[model samples]
Target: MAVTFYYAPYSTAESTKAILAELEHGLPNPLATRIELSISAGDTRKPAYLSDVNPNGRVPAIVHDGVPIWESAAITMYLGETFGVRAGNDPHQSSLYPEPGPRRGEAMKWIVWTNTTLTVAGARLAAALPVGTPGAVEKGSQDEVSKDETARKNEEEIARGDLAKNLKVLDEALKERNYLLGDQYCLADTHVWTFVSWLSVMGVSTEEYLHLTEWLARVGARPALKDQ
Candidate 1:
């Protein structure tokens, strides 16, 4: 049976889907499954949809054969292992996810950091913007901020504080190398890029993060990420 991924464009789930698209070998494009079914986050709260798989109603969940997988990290791990590209397995692709070593630990650190830091911070920032502003392009913005100007400003300040702290962390990390875990690109890079790339769309600036800005440009140049 084919693996099917339910995705919502521009959502945090895009990170895993983007990585799958960039796999060097063996990884199946879950999007291509002929029997694939999709339920965008826009409608995932429906009773019928959430009952069968993902009771929490999260997007980017995948159903492989008859088994359901929720959570982006779990999905990524499953895909990597299923394709024989898990760390310590494929030497050629090992650079992306190296064996049990400092590099691998570094990769995992950044991956978790991105999910908890960048993802959360970005969500806050997006949630802070005016409902009709450009930042409202993401999910939470519209609901959190309506036409009220004062409330929007308050949310914006709180969100900016959180986002700035994490962005600085990323900026400092980039000073040492092009990617998070060192010279090689790995899940860390892919995961963080998904949200950092959204800064410009939200009217945020990366001028202070020169290294991160440059690295993002390099990542943008990648052929595989072009599909994202």
Candidate 2:
């Protein structure tokens, strides 16, 4: 049976959509069937979705052969393994995933780091600013402004600093390699690149990090992204 992909427009589900496109690029048959959910319209809050697919009522969940998986990173990893594109148990074996050993360990490390640390930092920063202007919120609201706006402004400043620090760390990590794990493009790149791309769309400039900027350009050019 084909996998069932639950997604919402303009959400993080775009990452999953990209991964699916990549898989279809390599496979002869379709990997999954997409089901659009309107979160703004409260589609996720429906009883069927809440109980049957994702109890958490979130987008980017998948159902494979009756098994449900949520979280973008986990979904990507699962797809990689199921497709036999993941790194093999033997370091010398050829696969999309790094072979087992320090290389594989490094891949896992970056995957977790991108999903947790980087994802959280980017989200916090994005949440503070207004919908259309990321990281560009005013430092302080007018004297008559409500406390909520003031709090948002304060949060924006803090989040901006945090985002800068996180980006720097990523910049340093990419200085010596073309991809996150050396030359080969692994699943970790999919997770990290998605978050980084989100920042780009949010008006975060990556020019200061030359290597990362180039990397984003390379990955963004993939046909899978174009399909989305």
Candidate 3:
């Protein structure tokens, strides 16, 4: 069966793509049966595209054979299960999301936290930021940093603070462990890394949190992170 992934690299869709990439090397035959479709706005909203597959016109959709699946979280879960590799050693028994256990519980926390709390606040702050404000150097030097700007800044601060909170928790959790889910890397890393990795491509920076910085680097260094 051929599986086609529809998404945009710099958008929230990248979450699924990153997770799939993490799964690639773990799978028996990673790229042998999968196709990725970089869905641009023009493509996703098209009647033909929507009618043929997802009707909501949202991104991160997947089509396996003739069947289409929408939603980023669902897509990642599906890929992790479909490809035996991403599931880690025993995919059939534990992949994507493992059964109830300490690691599984933490994995669920990070996965849900990344999308619900992190993405939502980040997207809002991103919307508030003055478009094309140049880079950090330029944005930092603004004379007044308006109230609206202040609010947006607060939003970003809040988001980053929350991210920091989570990161700190993970870092402490990782005191002696390597991955989020114990010694074994699993869906938790893939799910959280997807969005954290997208910050740069999304035009956001993560210079404040040292732990987060290191964690993100480690995740980015994974071999499965390949170009689309």
Candidate 4:
């Protein structure tokens, strides 16, 4: 049976979609069936969606053989292992995911770091930014902040500083190779690239980091990421 992918447009689920897209290039067709959930319309709150798919009421969840899996990183890792595309220690088979060795260990480290630490930093930065759309406030805001404007600006500035520090670390990491792990694109790239794309969309300038910018262009050229 094909895995069922729950996604919402303009959401973090795009990372999951990109990973699946890359897998589909060389793997079997119908690897997963997509179900677009209208998150902005409150489709995720429906009882059926909550009870059957993801109890947390979030997009980018997946159901495979009756088992539900949340978290975009986990979904990508699952797909990588299930499809036999993960890079192994055998210097023969090439894959996006490294096998159980040094390369694989490096890949695992970055994946976890991206999903946890980096994700938190991104959320903090995003939370501190002004709402792009009129009348739209922060995630949990019941109304616009008319009085705490100064406080919010300070927070945003601090968040931007922290995000820049994190970006510098990533920029330096890319100085030695094209991708996160090395010359070859790995699952770590998928996770990190998603954040980079999000940062770009959030109006963060990539021009400052030449190596990182070049790396983004290379990975962004992938057909799977083009539409995403």
TM-score for candidate 4, residues paired by index: 0.86
Which digits, one per residue and each the tens of the lDDT, describe model 1 over residues 29-125? 3333422233333456668558866787667677787788877766765665464245554555534445557776776677777767776766776
**TM-score ranking, best first:** 4, 2, 1, 3
Worst ten-residue run, lDDT, model 4? 134-143
Worst 10 residues of 1 by lDDT: 31-40
Q: Give the Cα lDDT of each candidate.
A: 0.67, 0.74, 0.61, 0.75
Worst 10-residue lDDT window, candidate 2: 136-145
* Runs in model 1 lying further than 4 Å from the true structure: 24-42, 84-95, 137-147
Instruction: Name the candidate, 1 or 3, with the larger TM-score value.
Output: 1
Q: What is the per-residue lDDT of model 2 for residues 1-228, given as tens digits with 9 covering 90 to 100?
A: 469999986677877887777667755568789899877567877899989898887778999999889988888777766763545365443265555578867877877787788777767666666744643222231111223878878976787677788888888888888899888877677667877888776667788988888888877787766555
- Model 1: clashing residue pairs? none
- Report the error of model 1 at residue 69, Å: 2.4
| Candidate 4, 1-228: lDDT as tens digits | 569999987677888888877767654556788999876577877899889988888778999999899888778777766763545465444376766678877876777777777766666666666776321233433232443778877876776777788778889999979898878897678778887788766667788988888888988888767766
* Per-residue C-alpha lDDT of model 3 across residues 128-213, encoded as one tens digit per residue: 45654422211322221445657767766776566556556555665555677766777778777776665565456666556556
Candidate 4 wrongly placed segments (more than 4 Å): 84-94, 133-147
Collision count for each candidate, in order = 0, 1, 2, 2
- Cα lDDT of candidate 2 equals 0.74
| Candidate 3: segments with Cα more than 4 A from true spot | 26-41, 85-102, 133-170, 200-210, 226-228
